[model samples]
Target: MKHPVTPDGRYFAVRCRLWRMVNPDLDEAERSKLTKRLMVARRAVRDAKAARDPEAEAVAHRAVDVAKRALGERGPVWWKDGSPDLNRRIAKNTPYADWYAQVTRSRHGGS
Candidate 1:
């Protein structure tokens, strides 16, 4: 269960944080619950790292992933209609590029 120490995990953690800021869909109660779970999982990650326990770290990582997924940061899309994932890249390299650009432009009034 020892997950590799990759920068990807940290990146995901940061993504979870940033996404949470913009995600207003969750009501107060649900948001509170998920926030608590995220805090506990994050603490576990820190503790496991301090103890140098890779297996424990991996388990904690899973917890973190679960928490983030529940917060709609790292898992299946909440919407059912297969809408573009705004959380992903906006580059022309991806299929969502045009849609993403439109959404971004609309949000920013970029014409």
Candidate 2:
């Protein structure tokens, strides 16, 4: 299937995956916080792409810092990596593992 794209042509699937990795539970508070960071990052990336501006790219870098901090406070292990292999390992062994595994599997149609 063709992936959804933003009006500017950025891939929605990539954005969705990044958003999910940053905040998976759909928690209102968490989503709000990440949304703020993501906005900043998106603006930075957009500006950089438009004008090749290093300063604008820095904003996106800062946004990533904010995201790391937020993700870190929730759990030490959760901040390591957001890849499926790592997430699967954490989910299989941690308290929230079962739910995480189920959700990820269901989303990807994997067993």
Using TM-score as the measure, which candidate wins? 1
Task: Give candidate 1's whole-model lDDT.
Answer: 0.59
Q: Which stretches of candidate 1 lie over 4 Å from their true place?
A: 1-23, 86-111
Per-residue error for 65 in candidate 2, Å, reads 3.7
- Candidate 2's residue-wise lDDT over 1-111, tens digit each? 243322222112331331124434347887787778767777777878689888877877777666654744222334335423232223345444455455566668998
Instruction: Assess every candidate by TM-score.
Output: 0.57, 0.40
Model 1, 100: alpha-carbon shift in Å? 11
What local distance difference test score does each model get? Answer: 0.59, 0.49
Clashes per candidate, residues 3 or more apart or on different chains: 0, 1
